[model samples]
Target: MGASGYILRRLGYGVILLLGVVVLNFLLIHAAPGDPAEVIAGEMGGATQEMMDKIRADYGLDKPLIVQLGLYLGGVVTGDLGESYFFNQPVIELIGARIVPTILLVVAAQMIAITLGVGMGVLAARRPQGAWSAFVSVFSTIGYAAPVFWTGLMLIILFASMLPLFPVEGMESARFSGGPILYALDVLHHLFLPALTLGIIFLAQYARLSRASMIDVLGADYVRTARAKGLSERKVTFKHALRNAVLPIMTVAGIQFGNLISGALLVETVFNWPGMGRLAFDSVLRRDYPTLLGVLFFAALMVVVANLLTDLGYRLADPRIRTGGSRK
Candidate 1:
């Protein structure tokens, strides 16, 4: 199929997947023990029947499950995510406000992970049995196995407490007022530690994937032919081998982006970063159904979109797959 047709198909599939996600999230949230109305009533003082009933009626919780689901699905179609019971704001607006920080954190972390991972993988692949290779392997394994929150704490202690370099928590320094460039720098300053914590957690997978892919690509006949033809080592390795090997790394990176968002929840909680992950965390704590559902819907949508982009990227990176060829 043509590129447009391919994209259209993917978009349609994405819509269906998002709808499924909404239904499943709705069901799951409702299935969980505890009534949102009761929780709200208790917070207001006591869960008397009158208070509970009024709360339920206010939020449509009194409606039948199927009817509530239908209403929610209808609102989703109309771009209305309902209101946040705890925050007393529109769910979409609350999510929209926090999404920026989450995106920044995720993008920064991915860039760090990919750059370090791919570079180390290439270096290790070049000298598979060397000391550097062994070190990379060991470090990557440790990075992969470490818990994200633990990593964040260690970073905070070492960087924020001991050395006193980056801020221990938050998206920016409260004391600073500056222009766009300065503001960007300030945000990056606070962002570095959490981003690094998240990046380190994901880096190992990419490093391992890249190393394996590079080793396999290097063994291919074309690479040997390129070397035999007196091509420079750099050209043979990068132009011939790395180019072909990057496809798998790209795929892993795309999938990991979704995982990283989930991981960011813990990282954000640890660092007290104001992001959607933290928002989701708060929503869950308060049993705020609308806000939690909104976050889940957006998170699932992002993953679906990332997967679609990854497929398109595959076609662009390797022309063999552009004409509806098998990815394999």
Candidate 2:
């Protein structure tokens, strides 16, 4: 198929996948044990039946399940996330405020991990037995095996508590009198620990994947022929092998981006960073249905988008893909 045709097909599938996520989110949240009204109330004892009835009626909690689901989906289509029963605030507004910090953190982490990982992967594969390569391989293995929360705690102990070099938790200094630049610096200090924690956790996989891909590509007949034709090592490795090798790495990186958004639930809790992951944790604890649903839906969207990009990477990596619709 043509490029536009392929894009249209992928986009159509993406829409279907996203809608399924919305449906699944609704079903799962509904399945969790609790009355919609009482869950919204979230520890009510002194309230009257009138207050409960008003709350239910006001939020459309009194509607039948099917009707409510339809209304929820409709609202999503219209970009109305509705009000959170637990917080008594609009869900969309709340998420908007929290998403930026999380996005920045994730993006920073992605850059660090991919740069270091792919670079080291290429170097190590080129000289597998070199002392520096061995050292990196050992470090990468350890980093990958280590638990993220454990790494965060250790960093906190070593840098934050022991040396006082970085903030222990939270995104920034609460009482800082500084403006945006200083505030950003403070946030970066805090973010470094968590970002490194995530980066270290991811670096091993990227490096290992890239190194293996590069090695396999280097041994291919084309690479050998290019070398026989007297291409410089740098040109042969980077211009030729690296481009083809990176396609798998791109796929891995894209999927990990989505996983990072979801997986940070633990990291956020550990660091007390007020991102979507942390917000989702709070919503679940309070049984705030709208907030929880919105968060999950967004995460699902991330996964769908990530997978789509990975598929697109196949075309970028190899021209043959443009003709045949296959990775080859």
Give me the candidate number with maximum lDDT: 1
How close is every model to the real structure, measured as TM-score?
0.97, 0.89
The clash count for each model shown is 0, 0
Error of 1 at 326 (Å): 5.6
lDDT of 2 at 56: 84
Model 1 regions more than 4 Å off: 326-328
The number of the candidate with the highest TM-score is 1
lDDT of 1: 0.90
Tens-digit lDDT string for candidate 1 (1-328): 7899889998999999899999999999999998888778867878778878888999999999999999999999999999999988999999999888988888899999999999999989998999988988999999999999889989988997699988978998889988999999999999999999999978888888898899899999999999999999999998999999898899888878789889988988998899999889888989999999999998897788778988888889998889756755
Clashing pairs in 2: none
Candidate 1's clash total is 0
The TM-score between candidate 2 and the true structure equals 0.89
Write down the lDDT that model 2 would get. Answer: 0.83
Cα displacement (angstroms), candidate 2, residue 37, comes to 2.2
